[model samples]
Target: MMLRVFVTLKPSVLDPQGMTIQKTLAGLGYSQVEEVRQGKYFEIRWAGDLSAREERDKVETIVARVLSNPVIEGYRIEWPQEIPA
Candidate 1:
């Protein structure tokens, strides 16, 4: 099984890098773009025999502790739609 994680700045936080990209896009004539936010993506593959619930719990812990800063960043987990039998 594989799970995907997305770590991003909270909406209330400032994103200078994202702002810069948006400005550049306007300069490049892509003015239709309204906003751009920067973030990190992680893919975790599970090979253990753990149950789906256990796997999610483990990944959630890792994400909260090591993947993102709880103060300024938020994270979401994307579980696979189907598990192989």
Candidate 2:
């Protein structure tokens, strides 16, 4: 049982950092990459007693309330999956 929170900017909003990276890539001759957008990624580890659905909901609640700005940003939870051994 773990909790994960993923926060990202809304699609309509501009991501300056992503734009810079894309430009830099093009300068390096990587023209095949047409579009690039950046967002946040995080992996959180919490207790093991909570169910997957419960954990996701918990994160969702937090994201909606505080972690994410619904007007300018979005958030989603990651489901349980195998960890590398």
Candidate 3:
């Protein structure tokens, strides 16, 4: 199975990179842009027999321990509807 993880800074945390990008966009004539928030995307492929619940648990552990910073970051997992042939 394939899984995707998205990690982003919590709303309360300041995002300097995002701000910079937003400013750049505005300078580039994208005046309508209000804000930009940056995040990380990870695609993982697991070939195991683990059940759905177990897989979720394992992925959550990985995300919490290594994929994202618990202090100021939040993460979510996505399961694609169709696997590539």
* lDDT (10s digit) by residue, model 1, range 11-64: 999999999999999999999988999999999887764356776678778999
Clashes of each: 0, 0, 0
TM-score of each: 0.87, 0.73, 0.87
Backbone collision tally, model 1: 0
TM-score for candidate 3, residues paired by index: 0.87
- Stretches of candidate 2 exceeding 4 Å from the true structure: 52-56, 81-85
Q: lDDT-based ranking, best first?
A: 1, 3, 2
Candidate 2 scores a C-alpha RMSD against the true structure in Å of: 4.2
Q: lDDT per residue, candidate 3, 1-85, as tens digits?
A: 7778899999999999999999999999999999999999999997863356676678789998899999999998886565321
For residue 69, give model 1's deviation from the true position in Å: 0.7
lDDT of 1 at 62: 91
| For model 3, the run of ten residues with the poorest summed lDDT | 76-85
Candidate 2, 1-85: lDDT as tens digits: 5546678888889989888988999999999877788876767666643455565567667768877788888887765665321
